[model samples]
Target: MKSGVTNLFVTVIGLAAALVPVNSFAALGDLYEADFFSHTIFKFTPAGTKSTFASGQSLSEDLAFDRFGNLFEADGGSGTIFKFTPAGTKTTFASGLSGPFGLAFDAAGNLFVADASSGTIFKFTPAGSKSTFASGLSIPNGLAFDRSGNLFEADDQSGTIFKFTPTGSKSTFASGLSFPVGLAFDGAGNLFATDQSGTIFKFTPAGIKSTFASGLSSPDGLAFDSAGNLFEADFSSGTIFKFTPAGSKSTFASGVGNPVGLAFEPATGIVADISTRASVQTGNQVLIAGFILTGTDPKQVIVRALGPTLTSFGVANALQNPVLELHNSTSVIATNDDWQSAANANQIPTSPVDYRPPDSRESAILITLQPGAYTAIMSGKNSTTGNALVEVYDLATSTFSQLTNVSTRGFVGPG
Candidate 1:
């Protein structure tokens, strides 16, 4: 259903657990979760296989990762932060801190932590020597860095988000939060903060805030997985929840007492869809979505235009009948009106690659393409109009080109 079910849910099953070859690095990809009350840590594979990553901790509140794949945890009760290697060996990364709650690593390999009790932020070298980075905060709990290397802190006491320059100059980025406790950033530079009041706020780089999500119960830590899904540690529910960039959430892990923090395995991200513009148009409007495939092998994707199905989702005046025309730039390569009418329609026998359209009226195309720029145009059938959804799903990761833009230049006039 276009309502939500299109995202990649990586439980510890099948392809999610299978190794992703990231160029030359043999990465041991695992999801690390910290249990504060039980004083232990658990690791889950992408498909949900659970195991102990580390244990024997004292109120560990958060976790971070370095470029080398090592993990660091902030022990609020012990007042020290510990670093753990891939081999599960722990070393005192920095000591004599005041309830270190949040941890982050800068681009230069230096580690930073929010000293919650002292209302200060600390920086440490790769060798573990510590120094004060910024001071005079009110219970700074959550720490994160933007793409520009600027650091941000979520203050639980003052309920504000503070921005710090690379040289440690501090400014109030956002204020008037309801006990802001966890901070995270999406790939688009939008910042997300979780509050004790059960809402997650999203802020642009310009600091304009909006509600990204709500109904969370005491979410205390935030971490984004390799696929860009945000995972939150819910202290009250004792569960870990995963949210898509659009803010639809599902349970990822549960039953551990007071889960406080999580970390995803590190990988370089290749962006999917450089630009996307979605809207409702009138008449027989042709919405063009273009992408340029690279590499030599053929790529597969599920291309579809949704209209009648949108009414089930509360969409008003949705295009009663929609048509899809795929182009290799200027020439039409494929056209479809009803998905079930295609010769190979419903031919996909299994899934993670399923292309079956349940509604006979929906238009879909399962295409195998080569290295070139192509476009998909969504239009109404015979002057029909209003609104609809045009979507493309990659069946084989980045094997296909990323969608460049979804837009329309030729407006449909009254027929």
Candidate 2:
């Protein structure tokens, strides 16, 4: 994040390289693709660097991630779902299923598994408690959830897509497809499904259908990056195709043998830190940072406004003093002109190691916010102006809830 002549960019820190602005890229974070025939899952970085995330599975069918950064895989041949930590340690999360094909996670951290052979949908709590969510389908191959919490299923055999409410109510979302094998939803409410007959279908929230793309080779799994680009795992072609929002396609990766499922690690998925640097000014030109917290639980974050301290790092024209304010939709929730004077001054220095503002005049705020939109503004006090930095750090990174969709806007004066 930065401010430079109306330029806008997003960066997800904490588990990747430092802040660098890029115009076009393959993915925001990491992308995981499962090869059904090889029984292996491979991970790729934004620059196309590849490595085996996990291997030696009994037919890896699908890949998904929980809010806590754990990766889940559906093992179709073994009838089990495996959970992998951030470091790739594997453990059997569930077992005794009749072919787990598609895996999805709801906002409440519940894992939904589509049993293709049994025609059943199973739900598992965060603690691994399982219950039957839905049943009597003709082979559900893919699963996804919309922002409204409605679960969508791709029934490959029946040629139908089904929508299920949070409480197990089911309805037909779309029908008459040519073996829909993969399902995904973009940031918008629109749904994308990959069909076995070399075509991708797009469905509106009202169930209206249209062909998003055609001439594929047995496309199986669908995933979308933060930039709204769709990645399709073309099963028979041994390749993955990336599609822009308008449906233009390009080869993202090749030589992938029988890729079945695709999932991006979600750069914006579980952000640990976000910061932006820009020239500060008054009124609308003040550095304003925006973020949205998803999931059910509240999140504790430390918001900071840096100015004088930046000069120690070779930043010139630093603001003499900075003031910071945190706001919800309607009103200001918290404000801090100086960190030492804040109500939680003692706790601010120790919230986390290596994150204390060196200058006492810098502004900081420690807030516990519920799931919603928020704004953090940084400006110089007394109508002063100079370069400054604004930052928000998530404190509870291991919790089920996370900070996401973070952005910033400000002015950029000449050096």
Candidate 3:
């Protein structure tokens, strides 16, 4: 029965070209922006409503959540960690450190701090005892833990990462990073870190490092969403990027004021810490430039239109039926089609009934039309049982085209 349903769905999609005109309208929705310098965090819901969670912290660079639902903020300016309870009571959990930038908690509830000033890592037990876990580092800024309780630190000054055993012994896990800062771990024990130069690195537990993603402007803090997508906070551009383990990165949020930190709360989606600039609505369109998928698997991709005027667009897949849906500010507004299949060479769209694929070397989907503010959302999966690469472009001048060549696993959407 399931197979029959699937086949019917495929057949409907295969006949989509004849139904093209039925899929091109949209509705507008709410939008929100964050001011990093203002120390404010704004939330935008599906209904277009906006809310403020917190504000007024001095140069907050990283954030972590405790078991009690409290938000711990690393105030790099004050060299302290500020704890904000669920009730909004703020207090300094630890202070008097040299540029405390990143914080992490182990399974035993011990808090680890990356001190950039002293080039060391400090461990604070739940009872508040401060002890040096490792010292003589080179500007350690981000910290994470593996399944074996091993600690990983990203040294920004040396562009190296160190792994500390449970016995306080440290070894070089990876080196030659471009000012690596933020660190996170996938369930498989692989370490992911971001550099201040707008790149992401993946390292094996034994110390081999590889470039995971690039083309960012000062990618700082890193987080992972529920779907295993990595999120990055771009300090220079005031934006957030959502990347896949395969190496594809896309803008998750924009117009943020120098976003320096990122955290994912299952209950709140993604939280970012803006360290510089003021929050303002710049009226700039959140454009999806392109994407890359570099892993060993083939991936799938789906594209959607978003925003108040999203209903004005529809997706016509070469092998599927045209799907028309209303655009929600928070909802993905595109059809679920095999983007990899649509990317074949010399492919073209013949009304709502015919379509053609471009060459394999072509990295982007070219759409020539009038200019206006728009957002393009894409999801990718492996074509050969692994992952996919789908890149979208915001074209202007009718001849200006967007391009993406990254071959990593992940989705790209408007932030």
lDDT of 1 by residue, 229-258 (tens): 788889999888889877888998888789
Q: Which structure is stronger by TM-score: 1 or 3?
A: 1
lDDT of 3 by residue, 248-366 (tens): 76666767677776654323311111011111111221122223211111112223221211122332122111211212223533433322333332333232222222322112232
The TM-score that candidate 1 achieves is 0.59
Candidate 3: stretches off by over 4 Å: 1-36, 41-50, 266-415
| Model 3 residue-pair collision total | 48
Model 3, position 36, has a per-residue lDDT of: 51
By TM-score, the candidates rank as 2, 1, 3
Model 3 residue 343 CA deviation (Å) reads 61
Scored by lDDT, the top model is 2
Which candidate's TM-score is highest? 2
The Cα local distance difference test for each model comes to 0.72, 0.82, 0.53
Angstrom error of the Cα, residue 288, model 3: value is 54
For model 2, the stretches where C-alpha displacement exceeds 4 angstroms are: 1-27, 268-270, 273-415
Kindly give the number of clashing pairs for every candidate: 6, 0, 48
- For candidate 3, what is the TM-score? 0.54
